[model samples]
Target: MLNIMELQQILPQEYPFLLIDRVLELDEGKRIVAIKNVTANEHFFVGHFPGLPVMPGVLILEAMAQTAIVLYAKTKHVDKNMVRYYFAKAEIKFKAPVVPGDVLQIEVEAEKMLSTGGILKAVASVEGKTVAESVIGFSVKNIREDKT
Candidate 1:
């Protein structure tokens, strides 16, 4: 399992953008399972809905995508600071609304890898039931460091 600090070392996202709280399971290039502790205090709840706050579907997808990125990075043995994994495409489905205080468990599996990127199958669940699922795609590129 990975905590926030360790996640920060591997993930490029920070603060509100950093969705997944911890990685519970990992299989290098094959698969990964992560968690997102959704709470009422989340900034998005303020504007997402005042009376009936719900975690946005897109953010759920993003969480799944981010988890997939970690799998991609680990499989390729590339430092996250040196390589950028972009969200290239996704075919997603939202089966339920994720609400406050819900513990979202995201699982990602590598479907295939190409020269330019790879395809991933991800699912988000709450209490063992799937809330969202997707076939996600990612494109990896080496960062061109600026000499400043």
Candidate 2:
């Protein structure tokens, strides 16, 4: 089990943008199970819908991607300073709406890897119900120099 602080050390994500809360299980680059606490205070709820707020499908995918990043970091043995990940492809299926106060269970598994890219499949669930699933391709490269 990886706590929030431990996960923080493995990934370069910060508050508001940090989607993963805790890692329940990990196999050092092969697979991971993580959790995200969805709350009413999430900024997206303000515009996503005024009254019937549902967590955006895109954001759920983002949470999955964030979990994948942790798996990649652990598997590649690359420190946060050395590498950055970009989303190359994502095929997502959203099966249900995620509301506030739900605990999302995110699971990611590495499907394959080569020198330049890798594929990961992930699923998000609430109360044992699958909410979304995605197969994401990621490419790793050095952090870009242009911040501006």
Candidate 3:
């Protein structure tokens, strides 16, 4: 299992933006299982819904993407600083409202990988109930500090 700190080595997301909390399982290019602990203290809740806050569906997708990145990094053996992964597409379905105190389980499976692009299918669930699922298409590109 990889903790948040270790995950930071594979992903560029920071606080308030880092959606994945921990990685429960990882199999390089094949599959991964991650966790995201949604808390009422999340900043988005302030506007997402003032009183009855619900975890935004987009964030759930972000968590899934992060997990995919970890898998990619491990498989490619590339340092996070040397490369970056961008979401090419995301087809997501929100099935339930994710509230604070919910522990979201994110599972991702790599469907295909190529030099120019790749595809990953993922799902987020809470208490055995699916909250969201998405198939994300992404590409990997070299990172140049001065070119961004």
Candidate 4:
């Protein structure tokens, strides 16, 4: 439902840090499904392993978090330009290694929402096999107010 440009408008991450490539589906306040096209040229692959490159587990979780933030933005109708989303917590499990050339599909659902933030359940997979899953939380702050 959202393309890379649209995602860039909603998310704060830039190149090399923006993990999501495109969003395939989103149910406003409830859930989202996105994709990350991992490639051999990713910078992380250089040091993560010399001969064997694995997409970092943390980045997979980050993709999930970014997906959730998009849903939160849509659900709350908050302006990304006016606010910042902070990843607050996560409890994750890695089921497999994610390597280059794998299209990582991320799925996230809203578990609970508070005035300042919310909790979400997220999962990432490659070709239908789950690579990582987590329950993550985040908080949003208005940037304009913070400057005061």
Best by the lDDT measure: 4
Tell me the lDDT of model 3 at 132: 92
Q: What is the TM-score of each candidate against the true structure?
A: 0.93, 0.91, 0.93, 0.95
For each candidate, what is the lDDT? 0.88, 0.88, 0.87, 0.91
At residue 32, give the lDDT of candidate 1.
97
Best prediction by TM-score: 4
Clash total of candidate 4: 0
Where does the lowest 10-residue lDDT sum fall in candidate 2?
A: 139-148
Instruction: Record all residue pairs in model 4 with backbone atoms less than 3 Å apart, i.e. clashing.
Output: none
**Model 3 poorest ten-residue lDDT run:** 139-148
Roughly what TM-score does model 4 have, to 2 decimal places? 0.95
The runs of at least 3 residues in candidate 1 whose Cα sits more than 4 Å from the true structure, single-residue gaps closed, are: 145-148
Please write out the lDDT profile of model 4 over residues 1-148, one tens digit for every residue.
Answer: 8899998998888898999999999898788999999999999999999999999888998899889988898889878788888787999999999999999999999989775899999999999999999999888889976653
lDDT value for model 4: 0.91
Cα RMSD to the true fold for all candidates: 2.4, 2.1, 1.7, 1.4
lDDT per residue as tens, model 1, 71-102: 77767767878877777789998999999999
